[model samples]
Target: MPVNWRLKLKGFGPFDTQLDWSMSAGSAKVAIYAGNGQGKSTISRLFRLVENPQIPFPSSLITTGSAKGKFSFTVGNGSADLGHVEVDSSTGVDNQLDYLFHVFNSDYVRDNLQSRSYSPSGDIEGYIVGKSNIDLSNERQSLEDVKRKGIDARSALSKELEESKQELVSLGASRVKEFQEINVDFLMNKTVKEDCYADKIEQLKAVDELPDDAQAPDKLHLDDSYLDLDQLASLLERPYSKANFAEAFLEKVRRDAEFIEAGMRIQDGDRCPFCGRRYDEESRLLISQYDSYLKDQEATVIAALKGKQAQLSRLIDDYGRLEAQMLRGSSSYGEMRRGFDDLAKVEFPVLATTADFTTVVNAVIDEIATKNEDITLCVSSEAVGRLRDALGTCQSQLRDANKLIDELAFNLGKSKSRKTTLRKDACAELGKRIRREHREAFEEIASLRSKYRLLEEELKNKEAQSKRSKKDAVARLMANLLKGVFGNRYTFSEADFSICFKGETLGKSADSVLSDGEKAALAFCFYVASTWELINEEEDKNKLFFVIDDPISSMDFNYVYSIMQVIKNLQDTFELSRTRVLLLTHNVAFFNMVMGTKTLNEAWMLDEGKVTEVKNELLAPYAAHLRAINQVANGAAPSHTTGNSIRQILETLMHFEDPSLGTLGDYLESDYGGRLNEVAYLHLICNDQSHGTRTFGYAQPPMDDSTIRRACNAVIEHIRDRYPGQLVTAGVEPSENNSSS
Candidate 1:
């Protein structure tokens, strides 16, 4: 069990002065007596705050004149401080103090019974138990793994497909079908070697054919009939001289007289235009000789020879020009030029000016013509053969190159188509597999999630069932405690699953039917019973400390005795040596009763803003009220304070027995039969004399002390005659000689 060995309070609540409470080892119980609002409940609430650090600290806990407060305590046998609560600018406590103590006070009673009708749905203890045991880690982890694996597998497959598609694009497949259909055999096989055929095709295209006009002429025929053959022979046979040609021409013209005269006129006559001089016999004779010579056939032949020689020179010049203009690379033109050069190197017969020279020149011309004809025939025939051979070679090479290119293009087309087809097929297969795997993974995840959800539902159902069972058990215990406290005057039952008194549930009609004392008794019984159930179910009973505050409030003397017995039974049930119990109350009579039993390890009285240990002494407000009453009856001055004490004593008695007479005025007027001045009683006691807010002035003309003393005596005599068994004196037991009416 967790026990507070030492507790210190500084600037906290009504305890403005520092206070220390140290519990000795093996001490099981401590009883603290304090009047209303004297910090008895504050101590109980502080223990609760220590047990649950998450609860907000009470603002009222700060001392009246201080801004900050602190509470410190050491738990169990260890001297180390287990927790501390500080209230200053902010309020906080150590979280390590959770679940160490349990407290039952008026708040517990109100929450369980009086605040609302008690019902099974409102049973909080079972809910606490259910929430503590819920586990779903393994199922969630399995679902996550399934999802992760599926995602990873799909991602890997998609990456592979994307890479394969990129590879196909690099291979020059423009469309899907092109790369999809490609196979290894199609790639390896080549219709034509690219290095061998591609260049050959280009070379064949570069070889161009020559035009028809560029070819050599088919025939060589010379028109030498226009040539001066005799002159040509003469020039070839004789030494070439312009002067000898003129002398020969003159000798030929001397035979004709007319020609002679013409010649004489050319030599000596100035009178004639044709001849330069007059015609003499010698000149006539010379003319006659030239005339005869002119008539000769040899002269005419010489003229013809000269003409043939001029024609031959012109032909040679024309042939030289033709050769210069011929295309250089033409095979036909080349052959023709070579033939012409060979013909020019051959020699021909020389022509003479004699009559026979004509025939000789004619024969030379004929020979030259024949040789030219032969050269023409040979060049034309050879050129035809060479040109034909070249054309054939060019056409054959072009045809072969074109055939190789066509084969290569066909093979390339097939390769692309095959690759496209293969790519499409492979991608389709991969996509199908990926989809199938994704579906399978999705189905698996769905199945796992379904099972996980069902398990969650099962857990919720079991928790609800457990809560119902625990609530039923608590209800039975509460009903039994209620019966024990109320006796046979009331019967308990469950109506709408709520606690009912005498067949009526609380807050329905029980309030009107039962008195305030009965209601307080019911609340007390319920709190004690619930606490008993909780402590019995606790795993570590030693760690629990029970702090009960004012359990007997609004309860009659009969219930007070019963409640004390219940507390004693509880202490005995759970060995007090193991569990620590702190009971705080403002009821002096009850406090004295418990103190007289000698069952408590220690007892302390809270009065005049201080807590001090007390033994065998009555504590105020009970002691104070009793002493003041005795003093007044013994001739002491009856002041306003004494008047208030007289009223307080009467109020306490009326509340304890006849709770309907809740105030001193109500008891005085109703039970005393108007004999007591109720107005004077209120004026002397209940009026706010310190603040002076009455309709009259602050000095209300002090009532005659004798009159107040007489009133006090009348009330005391009424108590002694009506209920003499009740104790009214401090430090004195009730008289057994007095009897109830």
Candidate 2:
């Protein structure tokens, strides 16, 4: 389906202008023109409205005070008769203006286009992108079936289990009649005796709670305070004042003896001088003085004794206190010792005292010593109770066993019932799988058909694209065909256009790898391939026009010119100009290269929002002036010679800092071709002019040309050999020989 849209705007700011356009049926490329911000892209968005109608019109386009304005477009078959949509106010409502909106829908599209439905394209996306819808429907159904069956199986199993449990409960009560006379009394007595031993063991544990020696308050007090009289005495003798007293007494005795001597001498022996008659009156006086002296000395001795006694008294008092403390301490120690002895007496033997707990135990035991004929009472009540407990435990075990049996029976029954249900479920699942698989198979067939159609469509478009590309590439190749092989300095015509190469074939066609400028020619062949494919697809006479926008931006000047020449050749050879050849550029040199006196039909300069025509006379004068100025300037300097025979002229001109005519000429030629060609021309000219010089500098100096060539050639040869038959070629070597062009 093809669609056409026309838009008019009044208050839309930059997009206020009106434009009328149509996307001729089957055409995908749309060329837009204008400087930055001129609304060139706005027109492209209007076409998208048919594909998606939700985008609101810009507010700028709305009339003042008018909430909205209408946006209308026609979509349908090849003609504009399909329908038109007028959107105003609310954005999404589709208002059929005068024409009905045309929608080309097949039954498949209708049934599969809804959200709940799955189209082949959507299904394919699901398959590849992993939101698969095919098995989801079936899986949901099977899950529901399985859940229902599981519930039913559980219910059946539970019912069977309940029944079995009830039966076991009844049977357990009936088994109680067999063991009625089991002795329980003896068992209880034995238990009580065991309990007594346990209590005794508990009592024995009390010894651990007895006060330790170090912690006993009384004992500690005794140790701290106790002392005997002997100890008191020893304690008191530390200074030995008694011996000192005795020594003092002896000294006093000696002093008394001295006094006696003095008295006897005064009384009995003759005193000299004034005492010559000492026998009479002085005898009594001497005796009296001696007596008084003795008495005073004795008093002194007694006083010394009394002082000694006082000292002894203090020591004795201290001793008494010490003795009292020692006795108190001893008493405390004794009390602690007694307590400890008593505690020691509380030792418990490791084993029980009675060898057999029976003798002492039997006394406590209530025996069941009874006998009867008809119903034998063999065991006591205690034994009977024990037997009853054991029976109860056994009954519990039997109950558990019965419960397990019930569960097993229930499970078996449920399993049997589930087998039938599983079969039915399996049948249902199989049916679902069949239906789903059938639908899928049908869908797969439909998808394959749709894919084949889509691929066919794509192949046609791709082929046309490839063909156009090849045609452009080939035309460029043909125009620059001669430049690839012959020297640029020499003149050559189309008749002399020959391309030859000495290198190995690089897998591409001859035009492709023939030279550094021939790969585009080979690629051009594929463009033709594409054209053929497109031609085979549509028999309609409609054709496409290509408008290149800065296509040669990456190409050097020479290449750009060569591409223009190719464009011209294509226009002439294929009659492509009848449709259109809108080559846009900002480069003056490029404009000159393509637009000549008669080569181009018309020249348009874009200004404001309109196209203005330019004349050849205007372009011609610019070229003429540039050429004349370049020539006279060349003559004034050295000649543009390729021979080294002109070196003296170069060196002389270079001697002063004035520009050499050779360098000036080279710089001028760069405007025509590019720096790459300029350098090549310079190198060749330099080589020729310096032919006899020892070193041309441009040449390989004294080194082996073969060695450098060999190293380069060897690498190339090695690469070719390593890849077996692989070879590579360049199209246009850039100024740095980067080969982008």
Candidate 3:
């Protein structure tokens, strides 16, 4: 599963208009050893593009003063020569290098080595730096099994569905092309298959063509919000009394009541209003009877009867409107009868008919008019009950009609676009007809499709479960790795995903207490542990690539061996075809340690923009120190770890001269050449930088670039003056750090 890759990049950081590199197939393990500022990190950035070409590989990565820069990557036997990625143009790449290369760089450190923040209630939530988890291999395996089954089911279903479709076509069924031509809304948002192939097929088959000659529905429309008639009946039939008078005298007086009443009001000082003469006592007393009749309950009765008359008039107009609405509904029903045969014949309610309502209302009006003329007449409760009963019967009938109308309305909605709807229905019916003719093929297709859908759902659920399990597994590994590296000083909690120092959680204050080397070790342990995500034996058959960039840059000697052991374990665990670790580093000591002697053939030195396969001796820490000193003497600014290289050069030279001297400061006692005070200060500078003891930025400021260059030049001169033969023997090609002198 080893992949062959060729990369050509132009104008990309410290690379020029020409930077081409290739990895041969079967060359799984490789190294790019370089000094710190020589741009070896660019290799990691290039590796990232294979996974995601659109990651912010911006113009800033291009060297300055270039119009554009392009890179081409050939993956998997160079047959897949993915097109150029133009940083300025934003052009994309297409490649088949699918080997999962887990990259560990500053970017990865920023993303995955999570920072845990605490809440107000003392609960630690993450983005967590540490993990709490269990081994989830079983869960992961189960998911893999489910995924395989789901994929297989989907494939089988696809084959069967195609076969069924062809069978239907042979059996004279319409092609789904026609279904696609129709507007999607016609199916009310259903898929073409569901609309044409499934439930609707049966309904359409039962009802072949549109029905003609159907009867009108039993009731066209219902107005459940009808008025109450019981109150009206009570008002109409209530009893009233007139003045106490003889019947014969009442008849005459009732007609002349108004005239008689006016005469009585004018009877001031016994003067008559009827004639120009004063009224006698007998006439005055007789006219007083008219006033009594007008003021009595009989007057109230007449006013009440008139009110009832006005209500009846308004009822007549309302009844007419109700009739018009009913007529319209009946006409609509008759029209609908021409299509939908399920509609029942309608016999509209009398309450809905304005004529029937008017008849009942008019009868009450005429009766009330009679009572107004004769208030002495008896109030007939029987007649009132009879009229009320007729109105109540109409109200009940209207309600019954409303029920039938609702059912009819629902059916009519379906048949509104009768011709077009029936045609579509008939098409579905044709599908049903074809299925009946070729039942075997159709059933097989349906069965497979159903199973496929079920399998897909199961696969998704299992995947979710497995993803959670994998995180727990990563946490389990992280806890073991941290404890292994730092011992009891740093403990990782699987329960809360917290990294604690001496039983206390390390938050933002961790940097103040822990050394830079300790922090680097924690991050590296986590990075090595997180590679478990790619450990899928069942699904991923291809090899995995681990591109680790500068894993131990800032580490001290105490923690360096532990870091080397973790990387070694990582190599041993995912061995041979399973993994390919391409480690890029500036630390010659680290490179030699990790590669050992067996992997020297895979070691390559990268300088400027060129790569050359080098021997094991080329990466010696002694030679590396000499190079750093030379670069500084030539006025190059020193890198963060350059002080360590400087210190190693002096310490190795002085010890080679006489192993009894423990420190560079002891050189003063030996009467070495050059400034003795300057040498003592240089010794102090090297020790302070090489050992990260004082708080960062708390000690004296860093030596200026000029002072560092002069100090480095002086040390090189002092080395030449004392031990000139050692540099000639050690050579420019590096060798491992030697302590057996």
Candidate 4:
């Protein structure tokens, strides 16, 4: 499916220059027609290059100095195209698939894993002993069991680790808070007591209301002097009233005279310092008059004494109000004393409720918290180790399980291999027996092949009488072939071509009795049948590709005509539409013959290590020769038909149905026309002219440079014109032979 007939190389093989070649796709088949030494076989090797790129060029394929080539092809459906692949003289990798893959896929059996010699015995025994297939359905149950246990362990470990961590964190935070509380508790009473005492001092100073002569009380707003007098008056109550009043009155009068003197000093026509404005003359006069009146009034002191008496009553009232204000201190005395006492006190009595406080409780809480923290640290540090240990234990258990599984798997594998080996060994033993039997079969086949070859050789060697015997041998081989076709037991009369099986020949046919078609079919069947037989015992499943190279090479034209049918039948029988077939030949006649009858498109033609175009009839030389014969027969001259060249006669003889020699005569009538026909006919000769045919003057050295050049040009130009881009480049040089114009 990956091959297409239309695929071809541009410049490849013996066609040293570029050439666009085409062929068939699917059932179209492929054909290639080219002069000898033009790299036809080189093209065949191209497939080998594609499937494999590095096929060594045989010395024979090299035309002149150059072997470098380029190949191109359409891989599948013509859409998936693999473009040109070039091979210069030096272009090749050491490890090439074309050469190495086959070496790797060779018949030698090797160990797949180690790539070394291996025997199935050990593996077979292991499989039988393990009995791995006994209860495959129960594997799910086993897996479930394993899974359940794994889950259990995982859950337990997860919960244990998670809770342990949380407990430790909580304990750590509690410990931090406890330490803070203890420190604060220790300082709380002292701080509170200090503050309480400081407050008490303030309260005591408030009650005392210390006089102004003393240092001012921190908490009092009174002036120091006023406070001092007020305190002295309080202390000097009752009998000390006169002195108190004298001191109080004297201080008051002194303060009043100072105030008056400060106010009396006034400048005439100047602003009064106290009121911030100029004193008018009238105002100044009024002030002077008042002063004089005051001086005069000083004589009338009795009147002033009466006024002073009234002021004395008001002073006494004020004195009584001050006394009342000082007396208010008596109310706060108790609070001041209590506060002072509290500050001076040594220790406060413990409240009865405090007696229940226990160090044991604190110690218990602390110990619990410490243990929790230790547990957390321990879990964090040791969890992985514990888990590892647990995992190691689990793995140990799993190892045991795996051992059981391995034992079963090994046993099963061994058993499977053993069963296959047994079958293969039996098949091999049978094949050996069969091969021995095949000795006779092969001998018979060889004999028939020899007989046919002798007939062909006789026809080739004794040219004069060869014609009669060749026809006779052809008939004889045909008759003999009927024996194989009919399976042995038959009396050959002109009437009966049928045969029946007899004796050991029931399943086998002696070579003497096989026809050309039967021989070809037999060879085909042997290869294909043997392949199937081999596949029967192939223990390990392996893909195989069967290649039949020129299966009908020894057969006649009639048999050659049937080769395509045989191939088709085999392809269908083997389901080998997928199998690759690489048919190589230079027989255009045979290729055309097959193409005339059957459609085979997957066929590919090789040209100069590249896939190019080739006709189906060319696959068999006999078929191509037949085409040439028909051409000559159809174009032969009736007058000189008997005197014509043997090649022409052969062409005439092959035109079984062309009664009118019309086509052959048209070709044989003229000299240049015959020469042209001959050139065209060369593409049909599949015979390996390694031993040239003298009748065709093949032994003569190839034409001189000019002649060969003229021929090369004609062919090259014709090919190029037909194929447009296709060309055949032949590197020819002057030889010993002289050139004639």
Candidate 5:
């Protein structure tokens, strides 16, 4: 059972800010002193809200520019762990403190007692029990089925949502990591990767035309044409035929190829260079052979063909080196594949292989040797055309290589753009993959959410139908409310839920005849009676708590004491090991009475958003009022109630001499008063400002606090000079050398 409570109130009524304005109550008799306009009623509403949170927010509590109007209430046996009752403008209300809170204020009276045409719905404390007598077991079973289905659907929907979220999360992370691994500077981090992808996607629209040449970045010469076969064909077309040439000599020359080559250089003129004989046949044969060798057209053609062969060999070597340079490493190849393969979606063309290129080169070399060996052999047009055909194959291969290099250059030229495009391509691939892989989970979550909503609606309809027979709480509540009362002063007729005043059923007539004090007292009895209902139902009475806010409003001295006695009787009747009462009032006499003997000495003051517990002081209300005025005389700040205190003090003194002298102007006209001319208008401003709900300070274009303080101070001093002895009766001790003369 919860035995104690504490509340934090702010941004409502007099609090006017989002501050943790706190108070500890209910373990003992907590008395808080707050004058009118100091948020007394707002604090009461905080407790009332706990008993019933469904009540519409009272618009009157909101200030013009205050914090998000919110309330938080808690209950415990003075421990760090506590249960909470929360309400805010946003969440409406969640009353977790249970029904431990009860309040008595003008609202309680107006809601319960004054509005005599009460029905079962208006019973805030219907604290109702006992269900319908009629049997609707089938309808209840149907509602139970919906409740179960709702629970299961909600659980399944939650699971599906979690799974879908995980799938997306895994996909996003995998894509982010893959883009980072592409080893590009722009895709260094996750945010950069995503932003680069999205930005380039937009940028890619501007560059809608594809890369200028779509081929591999590595350029390799793969055709025999790149071997410069045109020059080889031209060398093959040369003539080296001689009709008088000797066959045997030619055979010898062929056999002695090295000797003939040397003889040709030595035989510079006519003399037989080898044997030193002139015009001899043998020497001439040697000289003629040398001369024939030097002028041999076939030999000259062989020399040109050999030169072309060397040039082709060197060209082939350059092509091989270039092929090796472009397609060098696995890392570079993989990067290229990732960028172009995924984005272009076109199959990458394979370049002509090294073995194929080597085969073609060897064939062209053999053909060159054939032409060189038989220089006088007329080159066949068929042979030239075949060579040209092979060269054409080589030309096609070279075209492929150049196209690949051009394509590679085009993409690499915009590598920043390429990187962006690559990132975008990677992102897009993931989108398709995600849609393909997790489509079921996404669809299932959405389907379950709709099913859950429908089940909840079904449950509501079933519940309403199941409650076809409900027992009215009115008769039971009226019986309980009439248990404890102030004699036959007022009896509530249960039929119409109206108060029977002396055999006449008072409808709205309760307001016509009864004074505010009588109504307050009558409302308090009903409030007490509701607690009797609580005491009967509750096994542990200590769990119940009551907050009485200004219960003795406008009550005379006799009814004030009667109200106090009634509250004490309630405490005795509670029969708990301990009883807690938090009596908050702006009424001075009631505060003094509740605080008990002057030696009791424990009192709390709430002023200007702060609370102070002043112990070990005489708890006299009028004396405190006078002391506040005296403190202002000695340069202390005045309180909001300073004007009310001044008015009371003056009213008490002026009426002491003449009961009819209600105002300062009336007092001034009397014989014992000062001249009537000066300061008469102070009556209009000072007298009416401290009074009631339309307290002039709150109603009119308000005077600042200081302006009201000065006015109240002036009146206190003016009266204190003439009636110092009367001030003593209220409790300002006379000074030894006081200037009362």
Candidate 6:
């Protein structure tokens, strides 16, 4: 129960200057009156902000050109500071203020009003109370987790089983069913009790035979000794005694051939090519020496050596061709090819060299007495033996290679069976365990889901029961309040836990319906009734504060009176001495009605950035003006705008109490017997001066303030004398300085 005892504002909203409001002791109800735009609504918005402190103070609340402002409220009768907020800086109040104050304004009515259909006895299925049921939520989440885990387990088991079957297929199992039906433990633990075909595999690996396509080394025939080339050179020497003379003449001829070939034709009288001189006796002598040297027997022996070198080159070329063909066919015989290559590389070069062949042939020709003597050359026994030994090595290597290939093929065949057996055993073990665990997990998940569903159903039932009880109570209170406000014009019934209006339910015309005013009235009745119900149910009723702003706005005059009665009833129900209420309005009649009906402990008038305490007792606006005019005539200083004030008072009196009286001028001319012309004249002066314009036919002579004040007094006297009991006067006790008209 935090009550606002005082409020201090600086540069806030429309109040650009500092403003303060204080509630006197024992003041449980206060009435504040302000014309439009006088900070009345600003105060209401501030109260809402204080209740909901999470809302930031509006930037527009700061006065123009002001960077910052602050507001502080004193709470309760002890004047403790409840909150102090700087504009544009802080959120005003906290949630501790909730339910302590309730404000209702035109916006609240518009936001909450709606056409709703209801049935009181219907099940309250969607009602929510306080926080959610945590136990129910936790149960649901736990069930979901179980289901997720079960799905994962099932998927994993299925995957493992499929992979195991695939692995068995890769190991050459013809069909999965053959191994799937076998006992996993027995198959894996059993040893190889049957023959593994080891002896046959070993025999295959050890057997060796050369391939049918294997070739033998070619035969070689070498002579018993190499020929001596130097002996052949002696046999070719000239037998003449003039050998040196012939040798010198050959040397001279050899030098002259170079000069003759350079550019000179070798004619009988040709010039030497190198020196550009005619050939002389020395050049002719050199040419004759070449002719004689060409007839020597040494040329024949040199030609025989060249022919033998050509024969050796042909033998080497034939050997190379044969060796390449042999190696190409040795792909399946590595050892055989290596042996042949080694033998060929070492021995073939000796017979291939041209120089070696030439020396051997020359020596052989020199030893033979005749050129036609058959010279047979045969290979040495040792060289032939080496060739035979290399062929034997190749044949042995072929046998070893054949044995190794057989062994690999045999082992590969046996491994296929062993791998298939292992895969079957693994698939059986893993698949069996996975299926068992997956079944258990799925069963647990199913059981949990079923239990969770039951618990949720029970929780919903309990919530429904609690909601129904609360709704029914509110419906009953609303119906009762509606009866007090509308009487028998409309029937009030509770349906779907809401108040409904009915004219036909009471046997009236089918088309009879509630007007807009009636609807608003009913809505207002519901709101106020529900609020009272809450207040009554509150633990500390005395702590409650109600703020209602312009409750009867846009309401019919009759309904406004009814609203006043309703408020009066509420005051009596909750004693004003104990409960605090703040009523603010721009409606003068409604404000006066409330003030007149209830005992307001304090009153305030707000205008032009200022708040002033009002000492006058509760009175209608017309009566208040009349009282003010009476004061002005009694030597009190006149209000600056007393002219317009008096005019408004007379108009209000005519409109409400005497409708036939018409305008103020008509009322003065008719009801007062034409004796109150000066009062009417004063009214016209007030209207013209207040509006800053001259009304038509209001060009009478001007009167001073004293004369006008006197005329206001005379009009009050005439109203009292003429209509003695028609007007309602201010309720203040009579005093020397204060008087009611």
Please give the CA lDDT of all the candidate structures: 0.52, 0.34, 0.60, 0.35, 0.57, 0.51
Sorted on TM-score, best first, the list reads: 3, 5, 1, 6, 4, 2
Candidate 5, residues 1-741, lDDT tens digits: the string is 334444566667767754354544444557777655567788787667666665567566666577457777665665654578776755677876544667898888777665663322234342322233134466556556656765565465445434533432433333454433332122112131122343334334323333444334455454344445666666666555643567786666656766667766776556656876666677666666656665666656665666667766775675576456545522243344344433333333343455555566666677777665666765533444554565566566556545645665566566555645544564544344433444454355445556656755764454454332112334344444444434566666656656676878766666776777777766776676566444323343666777899888767876777677666665565565555566677766677776673211236666556555645322556555666665554455656566666666566668787887656667766774553235454455445557544444555664555665565556566666676664655434555455463
Q: Write the per-residue lDDT of candidate 6 for residues 1-741, one digit (tens) a residue.
A: 334566677666776678887665555678887655567777765665654343555777667877666666555544554443333234454334334566666544554454231112223222323224433566666656766765665565445555655544544442555446433223333333333223322222222122334343332223212323333334333222222345555455334534433333344446654566776798777655444444443333333544434443454444455445444433333333222212212211112233433343334434332321211222123322332343344335434433433433343334434344434444454344434434454455456556657766766665444332444545666677667777766545656344445433421221235566665676666556445433322233455667777777668888888877776565565443465667787667777777776645567776556666666634356655665666566655565557776777667656765687756667666644345664546666666757767677447555677877787777666666766443343421244345433
Per-residue CA lDDT of model 2 for 592-709, tens digit only, reads 5565523344454432233334544123323222222222223322222213312332233243434544563443244322332323333344444356443445454443333223
Reference-based lDDT, residue 83, model 4? 33
Deviating ranges (above 4 Å) for candidate 6: 1-4, 52-69, 79-99, 114-474, 491-493, 496-520, 529-543, 569-578, 599-601, 620-646, 649-741
Deviation from native of the Cα of residue 280 in model 5, angstroms = 15
How many residue pairs clash (N, CA or C atoms closer than 3 angstroms) in each of the candidate models, in the order given?
55, 32, 7, 61, 2, 11
What would the per-residue lDDT of candidate 1 be over residues 477-536, giving only the tens digit for each residue? 666776677776765564344556556565455656677777777766666555534542
Specify the highest-TM-score model's number.
3
Instruction: List the lowest-lDDT window of 10 residues for candidate 2.
Output: 119-128
The 10 consecutive residues of candidate 5 with the worst lDDT sum are 184-193
How close to the true structure is residue 280 of candidate 6, measured as C-alpha lDDT? 77
For model 4, residues 1-741, the per-residue Cα lDDT tens digits are 334433334334456556565543454233344323345545555544433444464344344555454454332345654333344434542222111111111111122111321111111111111123333335444545545654554454344434423422332322333223222112222222112323333433332332223221121111212122222222212121111224454344334543544566554436666777877788787556544533442212322323333433343344344334333332222222222222223221111121122221223233323323222121121222332343344335434433433433343334433333333333323223333433444344344445555554543343332122222222243344344333344322212212223433211233455554454444443333323322321221123333334445467765565556655554455444343344444445554554555534443444333444443333444323322322233332212111122344234433543445545444344432324454543322312122245335656454333432333344333333333321111112123342332
Candidate 6 lands at a TM-score of: 0.40
lDDT of 3: 0.60
- TM, every model: 0.42, 0.25, 0.49, 0.28, 0.45, 0.40
Better of 2 and 5 by lDDT: 5
Show model 4 residue runs off by greater than 4 Å. 1-13, 22-38, 46-60, 70-74, 78-551, 577-584, 599-741
Q: After superposition, how far is residue 367 of candidate 1 from its true place, in Å?
A: 64
Error of 1 at 267 (Å): 83
Would you give me the overall lDDT of model 4?
0.35
